[model samples]
Target chain A: MASAIINGMPVEITPGETILEAAKKLSVKIPVLCKHPDLDATAACGICVVKIKATGRTLRACCTPIDSGMDIVTEDAELVQVRREVLELIMSKHPNECVTCARNQNCELQTLCADFDIRHMELPSLVPDIAKDTSNGTIELDPRKCVTCGRCVQVCQEKQNVWALSFLDRGIDTRIAPAGDISMAESPCVSCGQCSAHCPTGAIVECDETQKVWDKLIDPDVVCVAQIAPAVRVALGEAFGFAPGTNVTGKIYASFRRMGFKAVFDTNYGADVTIMEEGTEFVERFAHGKGALPLITSCCPAWVDFMEKYHNDMIPHFSSCKSPHEMVGALTKTYWAEREKIDPKKIFVLSVMPCTAKKWEVRRSADMSSSGYQDVDVSITTRELARMIKQAGIDFATIPEAQPDHLLGAYTGAGTIFGATGGVMEAAIRSALFLITGKNAANPNFEFTRGLKGIKTGSMQVAGKEVRIAVAHGLGNVETVLDEIRKAKAEGKEPPWHFVEVMACPGGCVGGGGQPYGVTDELRLKRAKGLYQEDGATLWRCSHDNPYVQQLYKEYLGKPLSEKSHHLLHTHYVQRPTYRR
Target chain B: MTTATTPNVQEDLQRIAKKWKDKPGSLIMVLHEVQERLGCVPRNVCLELAKLIDVPVARIYEVVTFYNYFKTEAPGKHILSVCTGTACHLKGASKVLESLSKELGIKEGESSADKEFHLQSVRCVGCCGMAPVVMVNGAIHGKLKPESSGKEIVAQYRGK
Candidate 1:
């Protein structure tokens, strides 16, 4: 441990801890724009400059590690002046469209401007005249508003490893754009929206579909049904001044009714059905040795797009199950419509997902049209839903807790934990172990695959046989595990693991690209805890134990992996080029 | 599809990238060789170089666009560069450029109707003492008047 005096207060810093981290620990605030706790500091924004007492030299606290006997002044008159100059320069390039931008008042740069008492710019504003790129319907990129902070670039390149967004030009002309100068849709962008999630400005953000949703909601002929994803409940509270990871599921359900959602459904119930199908599929592959080994999960749409583009060789090994919301969407238009005697055409299934990729996933393949109509008519992000609630003048905080509607609304603990990373694998293992052993899992928790680790491995006894499993989240960490498996398969060796799960976002859907903004590892852990806490508090801890899921199979769907189930619940993959031709 | 007929350009890019395979931070050098061979760094060529060098196309474009020497589009058969530096600006460089544009019927940074002559404004060519300098295809014409001298020089390179 190294000792440092930040603003004359002595503090012990751990090895490799940055001065910013030390100052944060000491409660000495060092303002920063580009340094996010979840990503590596790029030192793009120069707002966190600190002065050294001995050398009188200045350094960026974000990228500089604290020395043993260092005396760092976080803020001083000179440093404040320099910081203001930096802010002024950044403001000169960035458009002053805060009142009109989607992230108005919530923007970091706007907040800093207010904090620094910067009402007028002494320097002339030189906002770039670059046209907005709205090529992808999931996200919008307005280069005019960008401050060149490099947060979105780092998130898109290093954190996600998508290689879609990059610094195209250099110096004054430098701007964030897709590789090869292609449109975002034409690029290998999976529409994860992590770039927007990490952006300090409103330069990158989710494409607003709330107006369309509003039109649909107001239409008297339309039966607008809503399904909330497992992750949305835990993170949506952040927009309404609630703490991160606060579970607002019940209030959200009530608000959906207030917002004119004809019927409220839970995607977790669809997640339960997914476990029934995916667990059965895994059993057929791993336990019975009837199909390919190392069956990968396909719940996360971003991972699905990434696999289709980069890892198409793993197509045969992918589980054919649609995402949880898609499954609910399919059921909402088919089973629910048939039972309620509502016309499937009039029933527009709207899914409130904690993913931007789901916006693309809804229209990605034909299986999403399994209900003789579009399964999911529209997919909105958690942030968008929060905005809609506020726009509707609904008091979200004190809203009464209400229950989701009907048979499709019920879910198990396995369904609730689908929000976190390794959740799908754990949910699958919970049911898969039971299917093979014909008894409850010795431990339904499946603690081995839990937490915020990028990649996790575990071995479990299924029917007295050891089954190897691996869970990988954050697309960058997936390549190593997959390459190892590919190498083993190429050398004619046994498959490394029986089952593998992947979620494209860092901490799965809880840290989803469309979740609340300003997400950090601390928030990720709390969100995961919220889901796990829900799982622990529930009565039915396993998918197979959900009584409603069993009734659905017995009455409507017949059985897991049945021909009818495959028709509505399963889909195929198409090998896509990395770059649009 | 034009690249299909020009196999040598692709081969040259592959060879250039291979030569710098062992050297890190040599993307700029590799790109320089590509620009020298192709006259300009084409978008399609950028994609090819990205694969050959195992670097992202964006990274290559970032460096390529940074230096004004590397152009993204094809240039003309003969180049007409006007120095617009402080020394040349004071010496009627803007009037000289006007005459050149009127002679070629093309604006600055544009190619002629026949694609034989291209015009661009550049910084000092180390001949600032001469002032109002203009270079065409590596032949310097210093202290030329804007009247008919600049137009005559441009017309000389029109057919060549």
Candidate 2:
């Protein structure tokens, strides 16, 4: 343990913990701009400078680790003055469009300015004349508002490893841009939006489509129905002053109804169907040796895109399953439309997701329109849905709880856990066990496939045969698992792992790019734990046990891999070049 | 003053990337060899190099644009640089750049649409005595007035 005195209070810290982390334990607020919980400190923003009482030198708290018996003065007259100067210098270059900025009241810089009592910038604005990039149509880049914090660059290059964004140029001319003067859409960008999640300002943001959804809602002939993803129920409450992990699904359903949606559905229902098809696929390949092993889950659209661009060779290993929301969209247009006695053309399916990739996923390929119409009309992020709720003047706190419309609404605990890292694998194993062994998993809870580790591996026993599996979250960590698979295949070894699950964002959907800002590992864990708690409380914990899913199979689809299920609930993959140019 | 790229830029990039594949943090080094072989790094070469190096082309562009040493495009027929060092800045170098920009219709760090003229600002070049100098294709024209001289020099280039 390391000992330190911060502001005259003695504190104990693990060896090598940074002053910022130690100060956090002491509740010493050290304002930071470029330090993100998910990344290493770039020390680009000089706001967190703290004075050493022993040495009388100022060091950035974010990067400086606590030394033994070191006395740190986090707040002093000189330190405050220096921090104020740094804040002013940064603010001088930032535009005065806070009122209209996407981050408005939530930006870290705006909060810092107010905290430091910075009335106005005395320095002239040298804000760049950089052009806005909306080329991707999923994530937007407003470079003029950037503060050179480097959080987005770090997230893009280090965490995501997609390398779609980089800090171009140097000094005053420094800016973030795609390589080779290409638009983001033409680059290897997966549209995961992890960069936007870690960005401290409005420099990188999700494309706001609240108004577009509102336009569809007011169309008299259009029957706008909404579906809420598993992660949104846990994270959307952060904007409405609810705790980070509070499950607000009931209230979200109510809010959608008040916003003119004709029906409210739960995406968890789709997730359950995804497991049914995917679990069957896994069994067909693993037990009967029908297709490739280790079968990779295709529930995450961002991972699907990444696999197509980066690891196209693994396409044979990808399961032909459409993501949960797409499943819901297809069902809403086909099954639900028939049951509700409405024309599919008159119905508009709105998906409120905790991801920016879903926007791209909905329009990824024509396969998404298997329902004979564009299955999902529009997909909005959790942040956009929160904005719409506020726009509707409905107090989420006072909103009456409501249940989703029945046919495509009910879900199991297996479906709800789809938001967390390693969750899809756990969910599938719980049901795949039944599909293969014809019995419920004696111990349905697989504790090994949990937590925020970059990569998690485990094996399950089924009929005296071992089923090996690996789960990976965060794109950078994905390379190792894929390389291992490649090496094993090259050596002609029996499959190293029988199944694989991947989620693009770290901590899975709970830490998605389109969720509320100020994301951290703690918040991810909290949100994931909320989903797990909801799963634990539910009556049915396995997708095979979802009663509504059984009804769909009995009355409509007939079986898991039936022709109708394959048409509406499954899709294929194609190899994509990283750069169009 | 030679380009590192050969007639087949992609083949050259593949060869260079293969040489540095086992070495970490050698993308910039490989790119240097590419830029040295080619007068300027082309878009397609960057795309091919990204595949060989297993990196996003965005990082390649970031590094290319950061250092003034790497050029992304071939030089224009007429090169113009307005020195913006201490001596020149003190003597209204910005106004001189503005006039040159207006005359040539090209901003600093950009080439004219016709690719005829390129304009940029440079640091000090040991010409303190000749403050406010404009270097045209390596020839120095010093002690210039910001307004009329810029248009006159541009017209001289246009006449050529």
Candidate 3:
């Protein structure tokens, strides 16, 4: 360890550590634009440049290695001028679109401009004359506001392993784009929304469905029903100024009612239905050797779309089940409408989702209404819902807690956990174990499937057979797990897992692309904690235990895999063209 | 399709994968190697390499399609990649791109019908000192004038 005096405070750091790393240990705030903790320091931005000593040599704190007896001045006058100049140069190319931008208050660049008290750019602003691309269905990109920070590129490539974006062209003409300058929809983007999630400016954002949802609510002829995903409860609170792990399920239900949603339903009810069909399919497949082993969950639309486009070869491994949201959409337009004596066309089924892909998923041709209408009329993100509440002049925090309407809203703890990464796998195991053994398993709390870990695997005895299961969240992690399976199959060995649940986004729906921004590892875990707490407090903790789901199966669908259930609940995958063949 | 037993090609891929297996950002390294060997990271190569490394082919495809460096489809005979870093941006790379687009008769990222040349632009190549740099088949040409004709560059490659 080397000791250094920074701003008159002595701090100890590892011998080879950078000055920025040492300062971070000492709890000193240092503004950095080009320096990411996970990436190599480019020092191109020159914003983290600091004064070394009386010698007046300014060095980039991020790139410079720490040495013994080093005297560092982080906020010297000369250093401030250089930093200000760097900021000015960055500001010159940046479009002054902050006020009306989606990331107006959340932008890091905007915050830095405020922190540095930079009133105007000394250089002329060179805003790019590029048209906004809204082809991706989930995200919009306005190149004019881009500062070419390459943070979005790094995050897409390094973290998510979905390098759908990069900087294209040389100096003055440089811009971020997919290969071939193709529209985002034309590109192999999975609609995971990670690029939008990491973007520091208004350059990228999830598609806003706020107006469409509002129109549905105000229509006197329409009966609008809102279904909230399990993850929304954990994250909706953040938009209302609540902490990361705050559970605001009741409050969310109340707000939806105030917003004129005739019925506030729970997607968890549909999640329970999903678990039954998926679990039963797994058992039947394992017995008959008819279906693909290690069946991958298709609840996450981003994962499904990614498989459809790139990994079409592995489509057989995916379970033929619609996501909980899509299932609820189908049920609302069919069974639920019949029970309520409401016309299918008159009912508008809206989903409050934590995923940007849900917006795309609801529009899928296979997820269409049997009554000649779209299954889900509209899907709005958790962030968009917050905007709607604010727009409606409703104070979410002070709103009286309310309950979701019965039938669809009556969901068990297992269904509520669909928010977190390993949630679906855990929910499946709860019902699978019960169905296999005709009794609940010895351990109801499956702790293995309840963390922020990228991938988790476990085995348990079910019906006198050992069933191996693997759970992977994040497309990158799914890649690793799939590779292992391929290698195993090549060796003439049976794959380890009988079932696999893969969520495209990290930490599952809780860390979805449509959630509030600035989510880190800590924030994802906090959100997961909230999901488990919701599970713990619920009266019923198993998917099979959800009486409403069981009633739906008995009264309407007949059984889990009945022909009626298959028509509404199940779907197939499509293989797409690859460059190789 | 002619399967000419290109053991060297397969060996080259394995060698690249081995070199980057333990490195940070192995995916990018693999992509760089694949692009270098094939002049573009073909989707088949990505699928095969992904299978070899035991990673999801989707991940390999995602990286190849995501980064501007990795070309999914084949480029024209002469691939021209222009750098558009902040330094190049200040030096009028857009005018150069516009001029190139007109001369090549194809927009950026597109190849001409004759397959003689493909024009594309990349982000910073870490050569900010050279305001406008263009790379053709791994060779760097620094400080290009914005008004330089794209046909002239293509002619030079054709001559070579």
* Pairs in steric clash, model 2: A179-B58, B3-B36, B3-B37, B3-B38, B4-B36, B4-B37, B4-B38, B5-B37, B5-B38
Query: In order, what fnat does every candidate score?
Result: 0.53, 0.87, 0.00
Best by lDDT: 2
lDDT of 3 at A304: 88
lDDT tens per residue, model 3, B1-160: 2133268878888888887777766788778878878888765576568656756554565556555666777789777888888888898878778877888779999988878788888888888887777788778877777887465676688635
Candidate 1 on A8-113: residue-level lDDT in tens? Answer: 9999989999999999888888999888887788898899999998787999999999989999998889998899988999999988888999999789999999
The reply for model 1, stretches above 4 Å from the true place, is A54-56, B1-5, B84-86, B94-114, B146-150
Summarize candidate 3's per-residue lDDT along A268-387 as a digit string, tens digits. 998999999998888778766778888889899988887887678787888988999888888888888899899998999999998888888877665455446788888888889889
Q: DockQ each candidate and list the results.
A: 0.51, 0.48, 0.08
What C-alpha lDDT do the candidate models reach, one value each? 0.89, 0.89, 0.81
Candidate 1 Cα deviation (angstroms), residue A461:
2.2
Question: Predictions ranked by DockQ, top down?
Answer: 1, 2, 3
TM-score of chain B of each: 0.87, 0.79, 0.67
Q: What local lDDT score does residue A189 receive in model 3, on the 0 to 100 scale?
A: 72
In each prediction, how many residue pairs overlap at the backbone (N, C-alpha, C within less than 3 A)?
0, 9, 16
